[model samples]
Target: MRGITLALDAMGGDFGPDVIVPAALQALRYYPQLELLLVGKPAAITNYLVKYNSISNDRISIVPTKYIINSEAKPSQAILSSQGTSMRVALELIKVGRAHACVSAGNTGALMGLAKLVLTPIAGIHRPALMVILPHQNNGKTVVLDIGANIKCNAMMLVQFAIIGEVIAKQIIGVVNVPRVALLNIGAENTKGFGNIHQAAKILSNISSINYIGYLEANELLTGKTDIIVCEGFVGNVTLKTMEGVIRFFLSLIKSSDDSVQHNFSMNTNIVCNFSYMNPDKYNGAYLVGLCGTVIKSHGAANQQAFTTAITQAVKAVERQISKKIASRLAECWITTE
Candidate 1:
């Protein structure tokens, strides 16, 4: 645990080192075992680091990189021209084992591409999925995957997502027994979703190791009826963004209402606060699960608190050895990369 190190792309986010440097120092206070490798232009990162000086300077180090991938950059552009970017340099540190994991709030597509290029995929993984824990009504968090990585997936890929999702639920979320896994469909009926999802359901049911609970629809997502939900990237991404929009819209409405309305339903104020807790920022770190090394993607516009949460997630992934656990589970399932 003492050797746990995480490489962070300080220059990647919307706020750049100004926000990231403070967040990194804040995270170091909470995670005693954590060390940070801040990747960016030396002077820019150093100025902030010095200003928000950590209690233990020894836990923090800098790896100066030469360029940045624009927020709008495509994966092809990043692959061709941004080799020296902070995101690439941070991931390279993980590839070489200089760090156990890497966290970035850069261009999502670019980070995903660079991560795959540098770290490769886990032996049985076809492609990595972006996964995060969302607060469920049952006071537990549900693991959702493929939030925006691979737009489309086959039955086998959905099964692979299940395996990764299950491992995460058990290892990180601390589910005591078999986690109830389900495929997210348009409806819960057997014939409701696409052929690939139907195929995935059949595969899940027959696998004795997985506590497959059949199909779950989007409406039941936050009910905590399922421990893990597997869906293709396009669907998952849309669902996630929709939830964010709804929450924001309601919060805005509540705040703008007249004083009479605000006073009559003051209890709703508490609910509003809870909704704030449920914001995506609190769960800001999403792993590109299925990568050979641990790589977390944070929201590019995340504030200091949100960025701190992402750093905490990266440390947890390293501490739990998530990548190793997933590889072992895949082997047990007799899933092969070839």
Candidate 2:
């Protein structure tokens, strides 16, 4: 297979070029065959590139852009204002086929909006969704989709997210034969939620794309039972933040409890106690799904490690052909057949 070229918007994250530069270098070390298109101020990148003592080589290229969409700016307004923002330029590279995939740590809404406007969703899909993989305590990971993209969704959309999520889980985590899925709800009962989730549960139960296991209580997520959690944007975002908060709390408690707790704790408790060992590939990153190219939204406060993992994830997305495979799988179900 030919090496994949990834276009990275290097200007927008909180840590800026300091994070993006090394992450790109680290990714290059891990995947020597990959080509990089770094979008940012040339002088800044050149200074860092030379500090690392590697001349601007053939494999590394810079596409300098003058404007950046700050994290404080409204996603819609920023998208409308600048055509040459680093993120937009990266998407253009993908549209014109200069790169196999695109990535940015900028405004999530604008990134998705611009991507949808430019790349276009797969033929049967109505709107693109945001999918994220969370490190689960079950010796594996769980895929959560529509985490703050398209707040209002129908039963059909959730079902489509399930199919898209399953394809991604298979590629990234190597799971096969359909991982178990659950609807995120206040409780496990079918009558426990409102119209969107309640109706979506019934459809999921009959759908064969995912091994639908009924509704999942927020408390039951890390039990190692469900592999995918399907829900609307607001609910998914809240659930994710709650999980992060709880984990951090417990992790602090464990560290403060005793000096020998490493040996005193059980497997499950130990997993929850260690934050350093379980640092998520990124602090907070979202991959824009259902588009022609792979793109990611990195947390504004992302550090060098987050950038490293984001780039690493993009490489996997490229190798796995996440966008193309998601579209093909959604077609098999005849989604959006009028």
Candidate 3:
């Protein structure tokens, strides 16, 4: 594999360098051809590097920045004051071709704003969408989009998400057949959702390139019945978080059970193992797709392993030239509501 370099926001997440530095080192060990630019306060980052005994590692370099974006800052506030922040610097690296991709566990609003300002969206795309590959019951995966990028979307925007999700399912997830596309709604009936949802469904149904399977409820999300599930940011974000919470709650039940109960559960090891796959840690990275460059958003509260998973996600996107592929695919089958 060719060498790929990624820029990381060392001061972005809840634990900052405490989790990022170790994750960086772990990624470096896993991907021999990977190089990293750690953008943050030098002293803080170097402290972790020294503790990890990788201060002299050749594949890693530090790009100093003084400011840090607060997690609660608004997107407009962040953009206006983003000049010297670690997240902004990391994204700028991608804009200037200093790195192939960027990964940040920072404020989602700020990251989305800065990435669009720095890299620009693909031609014909109004806005980029946050996308993630979710595991399903069939041991397969589903492509979900607009997790938190846009709070509300119109018919056109939802249709665009369907097209983008389809391309992702085919290009990134390697879906063999025409990927099944569906709108996430309150019910499976045609008249079940809002007008925008109905309009988007009508549009998708007409697009020959998309295999629109109509509406899918929240309960069917992990059934592996559909390949792509499209919805506006607010709905998608809430659904993703809800699923994570439920999985954690179930896992907690098993772990906190009595000795006798634990023994009974242990007898059904396969059931416990299956629940492990539902852990949110395994799906920590969400791609800010539709940009000219690759940007991955890790969960702000992610641990070392979860952040490392985000880094590896960036690496895979860089290696696959995901942005370029999506752009080409969109140009070939561009659809408009006009």
Q: Whole-model lDDT for model 1 versus the true structure?
A: 0.89
- Candidate maximizing TM-score: 3
Candidate 1 residues 28-89, lDDT tens each? 88988788999999989888867876534998989989898898877888778977889999
Mark the 10 consecutive residues where model 2 has the least summed lDDT. 275-284
lDDT of 2: 0.79
Candidate 2: segments with Cα more than 4 A from true spot = 249-277, 281-284, 335-338
Off by over 4 Å in 1: 54-56, 257-269, 335-338
Pick the winner on lDDT between candidates 1 and 3.
Answer: 3
Clashes of 2: 0
RMSD of each: 2.4, 3.3, 1.9
The per-residue C-alpha lDDT of model 1 at residue 289 equals: 95
Instruction: Give per-model TM-scores.
Output: 0.94, 0.90, 0.95
Q: Give the candidate number with the greatest lDDT.
A: 3
Clashes of each: 0, 0, 0
TM-score of 3: 0.95
Could you tell which candidate, 2 or 3, scores higher by TM-score? 3
Report the poorest 10 consecutive residues by lDDT, candidate 1.
257-266
